[model samples]
Target chain A: MNAFLNQLPIGLSIGAVLLLVALGLTFTFGQMGVVNMAHGEFLMAGAYTAYMLQSWAGRQAVLVALPVAFFVAGLMGLVLERTLIRRFYGRPLDTLLLTWGVSLILQQVARDLFGAPNVQVKAPTWLVGGAEWSGIRMPYARMFILALAVVCVVAIWFYLARTKQGRRMQAVMQNRELAACSGIATSRVDQRTFFIGSGLAGVAGVGLTLIGPVGPALGTYYIVDAFLVVVAGGLGQLRGAVLAAFVLGLLNSYVEYWSDASLAKVVVFAVIIGFLQIRPQGLFVLRSRKLT
Target chain B: MRRLREAADAVASAAVRWRGPVVFVAVALLLLVAAPAALSPFRLELLAKYLCFAIAALGIGLAWGKGGMLTLGQGVFFGLGGYAMAMHLKLAEAGPGQLPDFMVWSGVETLPAVWEPFRQPWFALLMVVVLPGVTAFLLGLLVFGRRVRGAYFAILTQALAAAFVIWLVGQQGLTGGTNGLTNFTSFFGLDLADENDQRVLYSVVAVVLGLLYLAFRQVVASRFGRLLVAVRDGEDRVRFLGYDPALVKTVAFTLSAISAGIAGALFVPVVGIISPALLGVVPSLEFVFAVAVGGRYTLAGAVLGAVLLNYGKTTFSEHYANGWLYLQGTLFIAVMAYAPKGVIGVAGQVRDFVAARRGRAAPAVVPPARVEEGAAA
Candidate 1:
């Protein structure tokens, strides 16, 4: 019981990061049918932003760095969409190649700017300690990340479900032509969608700093795992993404404990393949006709 | 006199048609065959590895360019073939009943059961082809059959490759861990270290590459290639015409997997190493880059693309390993933005322009815009 309780926090914390990354990918995949290979790079940029900022201002300002990283990465995402991605809207394969090129460029740029070695982002004093609950010790940082994830999920859900702008965003996602005809500025929506999606990735990167080292290839590491979350959950479904993230996170954590990390990945991939064979549309495929 | 004039015209047209590509291939083959003698063994080995990569690029061109399946996880197939061959060689080196050195170093007590079949070169080669094909067959059935087109397919495949890499790295006992399979001693009982043997292996790779190129040309020129291109243009239309788009895609993807597997099989002997790095997301992207830069839609383009990009990589890394990433990134971006049809596409454009300027009566060559419009429509 103690081991299980201790493990849940770590799983949940990792799930938080996965959720953030997948949530943004859901938008890009769902709306435009584009596989942004550079999605992870967006997350890395955000994480690196925080890392750099933390180095300059010390650990106390980590929370402040999160939003700043979000904006920086988000802005870049908007620019990327306007310049390169917009041209490849209906051509998904070309988009995949183009984004892959962008991803390489981003990674190389990161490598050039900040040497090849792993860089650290120090944890704040308040979040550095541990919490003893149910005879199991849980790290405060992990728990905090979990809370942040939950908050972001709820905030995104509320925004998408309730707000006028959010509804317009959904309208575009559901039916781009219909939404545009109804006076929803689709171009603007695309910009905002990329901004939010990339911002979420940035937030995830900030969240990742708690557990792992940040480097040029940090995003590449999470690229597959996050893509898995998006696919398993059903492309574009935010709620589905969170659920899938939790499942994968828990499965991966348990697999790591029972076997090796690499084996766990193989098992997860096998399971995903099996699951996909069974449910071609995924765990919670969107019901809209447009995607079909 | 009229028959003589007609014969001369026919001969001239045939020569004009075959001149450029024929010369290019002849020159390339001559250079590669001569390279091993002129260059050091290290450079010879590097060229051999580049040929292996070319094998993967050919597969990508078929699967992606012709079939429109944006396969982001080809590394999974590549690794499967690579590791299968690697396991066999390792087992062979370990003798009749011993664990491989990597397993011994990692404290594995016995040989893995899955690896038992690879002891025979025949079995290993078969698995090298079959394993990736079967895996791709299953994956294609699941994704393509369900109509999971575009980005969804790309992401799923990419994720699978990533997962495969992680799995290989984790299985220290079965695989060679993160360092990957290395320290091969022989190929089918011939001493690998001998200069003669090394030269033989290089020649074998060159021959295999030539044969594979010919095979790909035949396949792409056949009715199957037309079907693939049709599917790429309009999956729904093809379906409406009573052709199963999924089955066609699966076949192309499977054949691609077989080619990649063969490449990987040869790579184990020539490259002297096969690791997670070689089969990871990055390498998979590199294969795609090669295809894209060489002209993904053309058969010759795939081979040229892989060879050129890999050669560039070898040169760049040898001189500036630290800065090569930047250089590669610049090259890909420039290629994608300025030359979407790739180098072959650009050459074709130039050829058309020159023909137009000369005011020569020439056969109709389809414009890229028409191809793009047809695809989009």
Candidate 2:
């Protein structure tokens, strides 16, 4: 019972980070229809952003890094969107290969800049402690991240659902020609959507620092998992991303607990494959007239 | 004089018709004869390894190029083939029902029953072809049958590869852990250590690649090939015309898996290692990388792309290890941006341009879209 209770925070924190990453993917991939294989590199860039800020700002780096990472990564995303990704909007496979190239370059650059070894971010003093009950213990950092993830998920959900810019983004996603005809600036919407999505990835990177090791390939680890989140969640649906991320995270936690870490990953993949086989459109599909 | 002129014309047409097969045979002879005579033992082995990759590339051309399925997880099948062969070799090295060394160290007292079947060469050989074929067929049936196409399919395959690598790394005892199966001594009673046997192995690989290439050419020329292209361009139109796009896709995917599997099985003996690192999403992408660079639509382009890029990678990595990744990355981006059609496609464009410039009217070949138009029509 105690172990199970202890597992909850770990699972929730993992779910939170996944949700944050997947939210970004949902926008860039789900909403915008860009494959963006280099999306994971944004996460790596965000983590490195926090790591750099930490050296200059001390423990308060977490506070300073969050917004800074978001903007920095967001700016990069905007540049990439404007120069390259926009050109290949009609070409997903090419976009996939191109973004992967970007990811490789980013990883190699990170390795050169930060060195090949994994970089650990110093946790804030506030998050150093934990809550203990009987033989079980849950760290404050995980709890903090869980809370942050919830806040971010809610914020994104509200933004996408309520904001005018969000509606424009949604309109473009649904029908780019139709949206443009209706007087929506589709290109502007695309730029903003790409920026916001990448910004969220940066934010997720900041959260990642608290939970795991920060390295050049940090994004690589989560990128596929993030893709799975979108795939399982259903394309272009924020609520689905949230629900699916949590399910996958909890499933990952429980499975890892039952077996070795490597097996857990395999099991997760197997489950996703099985799930995809059963529900090819995912758990929550859009009610479009499109044929399956 | 008229009869002699007529006979000369017949011979000219015959030569033109036989050019493709003649070139193919010449390449095969070059690989089998000229290679060993020209290259050292070390270079021969490297060429063999590249040929294995070429085998995988050929399959990618068939599937991704022809059927329009971007199979990013071929490394899974390749690994499956490698591991199957590696298991047999490990058992052969161990000599009759003995637990492999790693298994013993990991406290596995007995050889796992699952691995026992691979002890036979016939069984292992069958598995190299059958395993990946079955896996691909099932996966294709599910995904393609359900109408999963384009990037969605690519992402799914990539995820499977990532998962597969993780799984292989985790099951260290069964899979020889991260070190993979090494120190292979014999292959089907032939001493692998002998230099002559090594040449034979290279010859066998060359012959297999040649046969695979020939087989792929026949498939590409057949009626099924046009159907595949039709489906790739517009799946819905084909479906409405009463053809099953899913079945066509599944067959192409399965053919690709078999090729990848065969490459993998050959790779173990030639390369002597089959680690999970070699079978990840990156490596799988490398398979696609060869196809993309070669001209995915052309079988010959696939073979050339695999050989040239792999040789480039080998030499580049050997001299300046770190620079290789940068080059590879740059190439990936450049290829996608500038050369979406790849080398062969570029050549076709050039030919068309030259013909037009020379004032010879040529049929305009419609430029293929970066993405398939799909069932939208």
* Per-residue lDDT over B1-377 for candidate 2, one digit per residue giving the tens place of the 0 to 100 score: 99999999999999999988898888988998899999988899899999999999999999998878889999999999999999998888888868877788888888888899998989999999999999999989988887877887888899889988888888877887788888888877667778788889999899999999889888888999889888888788899999999999999999999999999999999988899989998899989988888888788888888998999998899998877878989998887887777877887778877999999996688656645442110
TM-scores, each model vs. reference:
0.92, 0.95
DockQ of each: 0.46, 0.56
Model 1 regions more than 4 Å off: A1-6, B1-8, B16-33, B351-377
Cα lDDT for residue A178, candidate 1: 90
lDDT, residue B9, candidate 2: 97
CA displacement after TM-score superposition, residue A49 of candidate 2 (Å): 0.6
Identify the candidate with maximal lDDT: 2
Q: Count the backbone clashes (under 3 Å) in each candidate.
A: 1, 0
Q: What docking grade applies to model 1?
A: acceptable
